[model samples]
Target: MVHLPNTPTREREIKLSFLSIMDIWSWICELPNLDDWSESPVFELVSSGQADQDGSTQSVHLRADRTSGSESEAAVIFTVCLQGFPPLNAEKPLWVSEKCHVSRENPFLPLIVQLVQEIIALSPNAPNSTCPRAQLQKLKPEPIAWVMDSHSLESFSTFFNLVFILRLFWLCACDAPNEAGSLYFQSLLPSALEIVSSSPLPVLRTFLVTVGIDTELCFMRTLGYVVAKLCIFRELGVGLQVLVPPPCRSPGFSYSTEAHGVWALKGYASMMTMMKVASSDGLKPQIPRLDAKESVLKYALAHQQLEALVQLEYSVAFNDGFIQVLARIDNIRLHVAKLGFKNQNDEAEYGEEKHFPSRVRIWVGPEVGATYVGGLSLSRSTGNAEKEVEIQKIVKGHFQNLKLSKGKAVARTSTKTKMKNWRMDQEAEGNGAIFDAVLYDNATGQEVATGRPYGETSDDPIHGLRRRYVGANRPFTKTGSVVLAGDEYGEEVGWKLSKEMEGSVLKWRIGGEFWVSYWPNQAKTSFFETRYVEWCDEVDLPLIPGKMIV
Candidate 1:
């Protein structure tokens, strides 16, 4: 048994509340008595390095009653949060890591400080910036529990970059007569009439200069989210982007930019989301809606139930042509076939072989005239390809180890010799199949809104995201994003506006009905799934200066 420190109760309490000399609120500002609100972003780092001999550890932040009272140990977790950076090449997006910082300040610290100030101001007795310490006592700091997506530094950069962009939109509304920021704004946009691209990097530079945001931190915040070469697609009404906040942003959590200074936005998110859908099963699915002719398409409807991890961001922007929008569904995966179970007594039930759908189509845009962005036709998966691959692997390994005849070939296993439970994913690793996703209307029987599909890629654009994970290199096409369809390009990707709706306030309520229909390949069952998502709302569109209004 290990002997622990026998620290006195009073001594432990005193140390726990060391920062109590001044409450958290008082610590943030310079005593709050001076007329200065300068140096507002300050944080206290507390650590209790003491630990037990067995090496087992307990947190020091635990409540006084919960402690053993026999041992006095400090847990440096809080210190790590302040100073440490997350791991490199983290599978999940990391928000901020000390790994990437400039000078002494973490780029995220300022945003956190401003947000905390915003929250503090919401209390019944808000802190008076010019008031003395006695009056500052009214400001109570609310406890915040952080739920991060992953330990990815990208998350942090995205957060800061997003706030900077939303603030730009807020500036867009105010720029009409931006008296306070006009001098700086004019320098970036030579003529108020000259439109600036809404890309994150460009907007960040704009925010840094016009709003006096830190220069180094802005680029550092992007982590180069937008890859080069795709920037042109972004301009051609292809905002070619969509964003759902990173992981752990579950219900009850809200991400809003704090309105602190001239550059600050009034609680606008760079990511605008669809309001609550009137549908009965909004995100909660009852059962997969199977269209009999297309076979059973059991979609992994919830993130908790996803077969593979995926990150998605949807973006829509107005241009002179039409509305260009794309919802990037990364890590796309789907089940086309499964090994069938003949008897019910087995541990798990498998279905018959499912191949890639005959045709996969994507629709995204307003409810009435939804744009059919594109369609994909996959090669039939009815052959013995999977068995052939396995046989080749087994034969190669067997021959290599035995140093046997070079003429040896592995034969297909007969019915009795075959493993009863043998099963393999019908498609290849990443995306089992690859074919040109063309722009066509024949893929669906219903009356598609975007005129007729203009044949193939040469005719129109294939506005689909090619999803591939580290090991899953195959290009599998799944419909989980917004694919807008249009004829004459106006402000968006491929669609043109009606003659009546020009120069009008567009109500941007999007209802995307993703119909994944599959005819039989080898599997006899035929079914499809139609999922209606209120993909976006008018509230999602921003009020840009020259760009179309929300």
Candidate 2:
């Protein structure tokens, strides 16, 4: 603690409260005495229930004491209350819960405290402080590291908000190892998804990485674990999904920022995956997985998007959203290993997915030793899907048609009949380098290789990717208002109700069957999943506002 403001010299009273966090900030910013750290704001928080029997309202007053001498004291108090870090000030009294036990020290405490202290020092309100070079290096992985040479406390506050979001992320898995609906998890996930979905992609790309690698590392490990637990919520139709762009590593770091669109990847071990596969015999990884890296590389090379000889490996990423990459890889190199497992030329494929372990470069493009060189991936697509059991969910949608007496419902589906693909064949990449970089001046220093003639039509095989799902869209609709693929169709059922039941409540249940199939085109495994979905709804004769099924 470098410094703390003296005793409260001024007090600001907030007229409204009850934990309106964002609103409270607005109130604080608008305060006439805002610049004076000496001013402690008092907020009035009312109870959710009615007034007491005496006709007096039940309420509490919360005082925000920022930058006070009590900061360290408060930090310790909160840490103990949350049963977080067992502070050195253990002499302080606590009202421990009988049902809960602080059995062990929380490993998360040290990091969070460090982050908070760093955030406090960098915050816009703090007095001048020096950020040493060593600390800056420790804080980063890249372009952001250099940017932080100057401080911006305003943005630091955004990260501070994400602090609890990250906390709930890890704690939910801890509290309910088997369910995504734990108190902390279920409540926070929707809000998280909303923010991710609504925010502009540029904003997410710029700041999310700034939140620190701690968040990425923490959540990355929690990913498989959390996803494993999400099937528990399937019955409620609530799901959390994160789609990391399948990446292929070039063998080394990206050379220049122009290749910002390029991606390099590193493999990580998940604690959940490790524990799930652990057995009494010892540490044996008897798990099944889909190697997105191998699949992507194979797809790219098979279609001639990348040279057949340049090495590539699959990498799991921790970064921003959907990325637009240069569809071709024309230049590259590999340094075969001599001492490692790969150096021993262990080309055997193991595990259920039959994937070879990943390796880095030994000799790269410029005649380095055995290795693979490439850019890093930072794109992550995350969204949350929640279905609330509505009184009229069946007839509630943008395409709803159920109405007055005679109504129609459209259901679209597909079939794996392998309909003939009448479309033109997708062409591969042109005879060109992915970047505008001039590798050589006289062209004598450059190593050249023969490739298929460049195409004039499309980036299909490489630029836009394999176009897997489009081939699967089928069963064209016959009589629905909307269009559907030849293999997909919509069944509209004309519904009628008794006139007397109009003013009252009317309920109906419709059942439907659908099939989802995956072929082993580039996938390591394929299977058919038959899902039977039911649509149920209840409606009053006179439609309600926001409830009209049309």
Candidate 3:
């Protein structure tokens, strides 16, 4: 059994060998604060031949751990540094003695390997960074392992590179082996969360600028990374809510210059796609509605913007990435389609699929009710008191032809033949079907409106007697007499006035509707004014024959 040295007293001036000074100097240099001292006496002795052991053993007495009572702790403070000192003047072994060797491999080698592997596996979860390298690697096999075998479960480790440390942290943080592993890394989870929620914007931007990288792409990627980490990671989900503060309204931003806008836009686009993927399992943020369809469309479109930018910026004009992005966007569009808001045109009566009752015309007099001419009775249902008046106006106009009923009653004309023929041709030619019905009145010599079978049109401009409205399927046909119909009476009167007076003109009337009338009157007054002016010149107010609004 080996004997260890006694602990020195606090104020003792104990004699020290040169090697003992070296031991003290080595320990001091390892101190974080004293690492810069290159000219100490211990360093000088090592540099020169004065303290060289030259294969001869030398005893180095060290005065250390004067305050420590524990032998194990005192050995750490005083003895280990000099443990490697070699003998002085001991004759070196002959170089050709390999044939006389007892064994080819050392038995301690396997122990060292196992020790190192254990250290690496456990050190990631260690509370402190410090670990004993010699005990793990068995660098000098003579000294006993510092801790007892049972306690040596606290494996040895060394400093690792930042990237490796981060990788290891993430790899283990995602899943733990046992209760101890889980408990040990529980403290580390919050630190990772803090980093995930932290804004690297300031530093990242500056770094990109210094490296001459595209700032827009950098910013977008940085933002995307933050969003992904916060939104998806189990540890960071709650903390992220605190980090990214929600804006009260949309902060509309536009680039004044093109310097690096394309790259930035691409990053935005990529992140959005990533967001969809990470939150695929019902963990995504709820996007609020904004002013225009284009605003949200722009957000969706931001991903594609980068593709365009790449083509424009690099002049490569390749499209593989763009095609993949388009496929992703198509998926997003399909999701938006289910919301039913983006498919406004699909619900429309004309121009596309007929979603409502079509060509619902009824001459309402004392004989017909409001439901036949206008729509289902609002007065009998959830009717607003104010909308009742508007419904009444529509009912009155529907039956104004009561006086002309006995004279030359207009025959209700339907486009059954034309619609049927069109459908037949569509089926035969493999073209999409046209479900819109064109209602006409032979006496009035004009088409009433375009409608789907299920949709109704109060008055569509499809039959208007104007140059722009002059198509083959137009509402109006040439008539011998200009007798006005119910809907066209005002325009006919204006037309008669214009013909009789050379300077008279007619214009379309436009005004507020029931729901948003107050808002339009307050904020959108200018739009109403401009429309009124155009209507006045074109139809209401008289215009000189040679003069026009343009």
TM-scores, all candidates, are 0.22, 0.28, 0.19
Ranking by TM-score: 2, 1, 3
Ten contiguous residues minimizing lDDT sum, candidate 2: 249-258
lDDT of 3 by residue, 74-112 (tens): 211221112113332332211110111112233222333
TM-score of 2: 0.28
Quote the lDDT for 78 in model 1.
Answer: 10
Sorted by lDDT, highest first, which candidate order results?
Answer: 2, 1, 3
Off by over 4 Å in 3: 1-168, 171-200, 209-550
Candidate 3 deviation (Cα RMSD) = 31.6
Output the lDDT of residue 206, model 1.
29
Alpha carbon lDDT at 182, candidate 2: 31
Error of 2 at 348 (Å): 23
- Local distance difference test values of all predictions, in order: 0.24, 0.24, 0.21
Worst 10 residues of 1 by lDDT: 261-270
Query: Which of the numbered candidates is closest to the native, going by highest TM-score?
Result: 2
| lDDT value, candidate 1, whole model | 0.24
Off by over 4 Å in 1: 1-485, 488-527, 539-550
